[model samples]
Target: MWVLTQKINEREDKNFSRKCLLCRLQFKGCRADYLSHLSRLHNMQLGQPENLVFIDDLLNCIETRLESLHCLFCNKLFKNQTVLKEHMRKKQHKKINPKDTEFDKFYIINYLEMGKNWRQVKNEPDDDDDDDELSNAENSDRRVSVGNWSDWEEDEDKVENPVVCLFCERSSSFDEIQSHMNNAHGFDFTRISVDMDFYHQVKLVNYVRRQVYMGHCPYCDKILPNRRELLEHMSMESHFIVPQMQLWDQPEYFFPTYENDSFLCHLNDHQDDMAELHLSKKMEEDCHIGSC
Candidate 1:
């Protein structure tokens, strides 16, 4: 769980004074403990700690945002320090925005994979799963499976993350992100989600992520320099919404930022119904799994 806070070849110690901007706590802490604190308290996580680098810069940028009265998750502004603290505390927005490109450098997967970014890695089918596809054995049990539920059920409760906003840093329980997005952001999810299957929903989200990261308005195509300005333009024009279905449904957004992004799991309302069918289906069929 050791996070690389400094460049790889740096001579200075990596485990220097690390700060938790969300919690307003400072500690001369080891990188591992700090990462654990972030995961446990904030539902904020990057890739495996070993695959990360220059984590300190990533954190410092977040800290600077907080000090300047910006909402860490959504980059929304507040009137003053007290209101900003209350907004985050009440909304539980302690996590990082997975869509934000500011974090892409810290993750090694983006660099390791030639054509794909780290976020896309999870969406692509794993090579190991392509086993014995053409095994035309005499006994071909179409109902055959490779693994069981027990493997995933181990510590299932601990694995479930606090509900995080798909579009913001807010982390809450009892599905508060839904209400926040619908009410505060005017996201007509129920209205449009009917047209989207689970995978379509994921792509749509990633499409929004891409739009925000690229400073393009998903609704209008107007470009801004940063997320804050883009949001301001969108909010000013009431553009917090989906564009035409064809525009968002692209192959690129198929890969999500977090493999087990709990927010993504919540996208499919019919998860229970889908689970039973998935278990009984053939092992060679398309494999799509997400956990938090």
Candidate 2:
């Protein structure tokens, strides 16, 4: 009977500790202080706050709310422009996501085999023009005869920019093309290509071919199921507009500046720091339990 009573009292004490001390109208303390006050004053056993589920969600919410923020992907917290630039080099946001597309692949393969030497000057094929000379030459080459080039040439004028990316070969405007190169193929466009054949051939091709790409918006980090959804995201205010300048330019590659004001620069750093600490504490607790 004594043991049963003791057990019941213990459960009651635990439940009392779990209630939010500052949650009531009478008390208006923050979560940490209220929890601490309850444990210390009422001799209550502390447990996790009911509202917070995963630490990531809590941290993310807190992080967005703060005034000065850090890059979530990079550890660099930005109070100013100088700090942000330092972060970009160290964090290398360009490297994290390779924006490879199907069109990039076609462009790269075709560019490697056939240089950008030919231009289709005429829209109409002249019946009197010499098809026999080109056909005979093509027929002589054993490997080149594999695919129908004439059929490809007929439709080629419809497509702009045949220079296929090793990752995607779609005809994107020049501004968007570099992003495809960096994100999908893992080619740092700024770096000088040491081995032209290797860059166009083995290294770049192997980089993206090995991995399965689910296309994501570079600005919002939203992974869409299809290209249509990605296009919709690109048009919306939430997504970063691809700058008119070359993608390799520091302004385009680093800070996503649609306007003079920056959203990332004005993030909540303190809240993010606090949330990270809280998460670290929880992880430590979990690890301890697991190890034991």
Q: How many backbone clashes does every candidate have?
A: 1, 25
- Give me the runs in candidate 2 sitting further than 4 Å from their true place: 1-98, 101-259, 262-266
- Over 156-239, each residue of candidate 1 has an lDDT whose tens digit, in order, gives 434246765655566765257778888877886756776556567777877876676677998988999886787788889999
Candidate 2 minimal-lDDT segment of 10 residues: 259-268
Per-model lDDT: 0.64, 0.36
Clashing pairs in 1: 73-169
What lDDT score is found at residue 118 in candidate 2? 15
Candidate number achieving the greatest TM-score relative to the actual structure: 1
Regions of candidate 1 where Cα sits further than 4 Å from its true position: 1-160, 269-292
Instruction: In model 1, state the lDDT of residue 156.
Output: 46
lDDT score for residue 26 of model 1? 79
